[model samples]
Target: MNSTLQPTALTEHVPQPVTRTERVQTIDLIRGFALLGILMMNIPGFGFPYTRFPLIYGTPGSTDFYTAMGIDTAFSGTMRALFSMLFGAGMLLFMAKKEDLASGHSVVDFYYRRLLWLVLFGVINAYVLLWPGDILYAYGLCGLLLYPFRKLRPAYLLIGMMLCMILPVLRNIQNTVETKQKRTTYWEAVKAEEQKKKLTDEQKKAKEEWENQLKWTKFDTKKDAEIVRKMQLGYGQVFAKLMPRNSNIESRGMYYGFWDMLGMMFLGMALLKLGFFTNKLPTSTYWLTLGLGYSIGLLLGNIQFYDQVAYILDPGAYVDTHFFSVFDLYDLRRGATAIGHASLLLLVYRSGVVPWLMKALANVGQMAFTNYLMQSIICTLIFYGYGFGYYGKLAFHQLYYVVAGVWVFQILFSAVWLRYFRFGPFEWLWRSLTYWKRQPMRLQSEPVPAAPQTALF
Candidate 1:
């Protein structure tokens, strides 16, 4: 008795990967939907040197213009918002069980280990793969700060989320004020120069600032051409060109965007804790959420879209007329839209009318990590010089053809791959690394375990 141990004693406290039966199907479905939707916004960045000018890419009211407008209105930041929220929910899911603590294995250790690996994967995605818009690095870094708040009440998490959002809103206000000041100074300086008057230092600085900003926002054919040429260079040359941009995004951009991601994550945690992501809420509640979320989100989103169209038509006038009011509510619009999207999808899932489509999407979501990296690899190869070298050649609307192809491939591939395997390739690798052991990969011939009808949360 003193020397022996029961089977439960040895196995019950060991940490393990989430089984398929334990997964929340609604979460997977939403994730899969978000993964595909992200490509709608990302395709432009993949195929074009700059994505600001639908007017230049195509005439006003053309297919390109409408495409850009539609994407801006419907997707833009919404897919990423969904992903961020899901990531937060996942953190709680990972730490939900406390049995590991009894076996001297801290869940915190596993969580950090998972995040560090994600950080490395993000580096590989951004630097090695040359995808400057990669979100993994930002997510990994932000996730490091999530563990401390895991046990907070849902209400407290919501409060934290709102608090975090305040920073980005304030930043928008600051940027708007600074931009207006720069424009005023530059115009005054222009008038003074015309009168043969000496320019003040502040005016000179403002002129330079405004011009630099124009270099990015205002279309210049020559600059665009140079970007195309660089993207069409050899791997080493392209990497050299992309390095600084990726560095800036990883450093400065990540810093500024940290609170945004963190806030969404907090919201995700709150939602999961409240049973929103698990589809445990009442049907009427979901209906009400869909109604209110879309009503508010679309209203604000359309206003922002109108401003975007106005900017495309006349940047100068758009700047003069548009303050940061709509921009300040950017988070709210996307956040609401994301929630609406989730509600609609959940309603559909609950209805069971599109079982095949839902099942396929859930499979895709299950393999989301692999599919995400695959998108980067496939898109870079298609657009970069070392492969197809089609960068900057496709119009705004044409890129969706590529997106549609990727979606078809990923959906089919995920369904087939999971038939024989328990996890996506990357997911298995990540779990293996986190556990410091090779987790099971291949599905055995045993009877499939039925999924829980309700989520643990």
Candidate 2:
């Protein structure tokens, strides 16, 4: 056993492609898209100008709506799916090659090191950086749970993933129905209280304040004092009400999200086994899948878009008056929509399309672990009190300008950094620490094993 071997390393004993295929490019291309598109979702969370977290929970302007419908809806929801699928695909490729290079070490042991590294990176990103929104934490947590199921049949993994994705949706539906029923009861209570007219002035004031806290807190601040009071009262209620739900959501959310990611990752693994991502599929098949996938997604997205608008305008009263709520809410489309985007990305890979863009994207992706953390650090400095303190001050439209500026910096810096170096700075450190041995940082004269290929579906 070469104690120096890495799960991401290319080995001589690994099989070479007989066909003129570009498997590494395929993964890189998909990863490239995932890395860039993830910003669409994350930019909003960087500051208060975009759609608020838990999405659908905040006020947004025309720019926010357009961003949601166009960029965020088109790419944000699906890109992570593509990224997760590539991860799964990579996992399969890594496992396949591990058999050739290392016999004694278990895949679980190998993956534990990887996940631990990821978690450590994520923790640093969350606590040290200004941005607390960290996907690494989520991904690391999920990656750990996925290792044991690696040997399961592809069909079983797919079924398991579907059940996992569905759990959150079902829970959301149950909660929505319950909330709707409770709102009705709450309104009835208010009406009864109004009729009785027995409450003291202080009680009335307190009740009004509670209602304002629940519904109008988003717009309540005009000064630092108001902001401070709002933050305290807001957090107090959040801890009082939402903290109980947090445990429930985090438990189930992590499970569902993990399964969803693993399902795609494993599907990617299975596809790699079949040579789908390695460009082994027929050209005709690629285009057909792309067309079908995008068409279905566009149709569903439109339906969901209309539903959100109707809900925002009238809520129960509008839906009750019209038959428009027949379509599913945008929030409910996460699973299917994610799958649809992944399908489209697969087609792009199969066709070997967009070579230059893919190269830049791959460069970005190669350094993704670094870039992901860097984004948090940079954005936090721009938005938080410990840095720029611009968090709640920026408008929805202005946030787009900030996002654009950051994107330009990341892309240009990524391209420049890769030219002089072999890997992103953090990536170099991660591989070095993982193997407990020094790995080549630049392309050496010695033959380097390319990233492993994927199988056609």
Best by TM-score: 1
Lowest lDDT 10-mer window, candidate 1? 1-10
Model 1 segments beyond 4 Å from truth? 1-13, 51-58, 99-103, 445-457
- Which clashing pairs does model 1 show? none
In candidate 2, what are the lDDT values of residues 38-78, reduced to their tens digit? 77677766666322321332334565566656654465467
**How do all models score by TM-score?**
0.93, 0.76
In terms of lDDT, model 1 sits at 0.83
Q: In order, what lDDT does every prediction score?
A: 0.83, 0.56
The deviation in Å at residue 272 for candidate 1 is 0.5
Backbone clash total, candidate 2: 10
* lDDT for position 448 in model 1: 40
lDDT at 257, model 2: 61
